[model samples]
Target: MKRIVIALALVLCAAQPTLADKVAAPIPIGIAVAQTSNVALFGQEQVNGAKLAEERLNAAGGVNGTKIALVFQDTAGDEAGAVNAFQNLLNRDKVVAIIGPTLSQQAFAANPIADRAKTPVVGPSNTAKGIPEIGEFVGRISAPMTQVAPNSLKQAMKIKPDLKRVAVLYAQNDAFSSSETTTFQDAIKELGLETVTVQKFQTTDTDFTTQVTAVLGANADLVVISGLAADSGNLVKQLRQLGYKGLIVGGNGLNSPNMFPVCGALCNDVLVAQAYSPGAVDKNPVNKDFAAAFEAAYKKGPAQFSAQAYAAVQVVVEALAKIEKETGKKIADFELADLRAALNKSLRTGTYLTPMGEISMAPSGEVQQKDFYVSKIVMNPDGKTGSFVLVSE
Candidate 1:
């Protein structure tokens, strides 16, 4: 009888799951961004940033020794694609939180789904106004256009105090560009500059001859462009080719090195408003480490998109760690729904040292970033390579 009882006890012990099994199971987080289409230029950088965060966090013991797994879903630069990606991450992948859907237009469509599903979302590049107001679960690391869009104009005024006429152009189809242009126009009016013309173009439009002719007709001394990489770069190139020699100020949308290839030699001297700069090595040690890792991986400096995406990942991980410490329970052991709810609450309560500098979230889910920058694109003589040389902060 004793031998039979011992044998049954041993079998029961073997049938139960072990702590090792629980530790081995990674906590899933979703990354939904455009990996295809014209927006890929920005999306690809975001992917690189998030991947680096995953590797670094896992190596350092993620979420109190519970590893994190980043499940990727390509948003493909459209509303429908973003919706599909969010649905898959929420329902199929069962992610705790999500980061992305690159454009504000896509975010408008996709963020609501996550909000309704009670999943937390961090916007890496969706800078349109009212992004955080999408829901209580939605927040962003990217600063609003109100903070970032006016810096370039201020910098331009410093360079040319006599500058008068300003022509504004933007991608009308893009929600970000549309919202950003409003801010730009307000700045122009405040500075008492004449509004020579306002031109609109679709994100898909390649032929900008009509827009270029209108800019020339007005003889605008300064041309401000608010559009994405491909279209904005092409517009800058066309403006230069058609013989407009005045200073060109680009919006936050053109704040990437990807603009170099699109406009070539003409990309030089375009002033861009920036939220992140890899050149700020002396200010923050975290930025120094991030920039080094990025350069090692890509053989080039990181852009704003990369830095913001990395910050988003860091926010999630740190919040989880906080939860684990407060509750004295591993995040992996918490019910998924409970853990996610805790994370949303924690994200709004802390200040983070990110590549963008020290930032904290307002109760409204807006990121209150301390630093903003304006830089001028300095192209090499080869016209194929360039860097954003910081001018003001």
Candidate 2:
């Protein structure tokens, strides 16, 4: 009888799930970004930023003792590619939540999948207006173009108050570019400035001579460019090479330091509206630490997208931690509905300290903070190009 009782006890012990086993199953977080195409330069930076966040979270023992495993999918910077990447992450990888689809166009195409799956998605860089209109599942850390565009306009006016004629150049194929162009046009109209010419180009276009000729022929006082970094940088270089010496204003697409390489000396005097700046003198602790750590890791300054991506991941990790504290259960077994509620509640009320200063989300998934700055590229006396001055509203 004693032997039989001991045998039954052993069987029961083997059937029980151990805490170590539970914690061993890491929670999968999806990273969907444009890793391959025209926007790859910016997307690569966003990927690095997300990876940095993942590394930090995992090193701190992860959320609720469960490790975080990042699964990356390349969207290739197109609508179809975004759909495929999102579906693969959702259906094949079974990620609890997805982090990006960097471009606003990709987000518009891919966010609906997460919505239908009831999986939460936080955009790292989708700044186009009406992103929140996608669904309740959609959220973004980046400020909308409605806010970013006016900063460039304000800076342009400061440089040339009598800038009446503005020429707009944009990539018609990109939703983000189109949306930004609309914002620029609207802001110019409000300022009583006439749009002398609106030129369109493809993302794949290598030469902008024809477009530059058209813009210059219009005799505009300012030229505003709305496109991805690669195309926008080339456009700026081509405009200068074509002898169009007017003031240049770049939209969110030209906010990266990589633009300097494309335009070289021509990048001087160009002004851009930025959502994040390591050079910003904000006294927030979060921004200070993030700026330091980012420079240490990447050996370069962080951009608005990088800062926002870091913040988005931070908020998600916080939500996971909160869920664990409340339920005392692993995040993997947590229901999507419960997780979504926790995330929404946490994101809305909680203050996040990112490299862009303090940011919070509203119930409608809109970012509560409207912090933006205008920075001009100046070639210092030493011949090094940098954002010399930042003008803030």
Where does candidate 1 stray beyond 4 Å?
1-24, 204-209
Give the alpha carbon lDDT tens digit for every residue of 1-393 in model 2. 999999999888773422321112577778898899977877888888888888887888888677888889999978999999999987677776788998887888889988887678888888878787798878877888887788888888977787889999999997778888999999989988899999999978889998999998999889999987778878988998988888999887777676666666777878888888767855666777777888899898777767777777887877778777877766776654556556556656666766676677777778766477788887554443555357554
Candidate 1 local accuracy as lDDT? 0.90
lDDT of each: 0.90, 0.79
Cα lDDT tens digits, model 1, 1-393, are 999999999988773431322222588989999999978978999999999999988999988888999999999988999999999998778888999979988999999999987889999988888799999999999998988978899899999999999999999998778999999999999988989999999989999999999999999999999998889999999999999999999998788777899999999999988889888778789999999999998898888889999999998989888888888887767766776788899889879999889888887789999988889999998998898998987
Which candidate has the top score in TM-score? 1
Clashing pairs in 2: none
TM-score of each: 0.87, 0.81
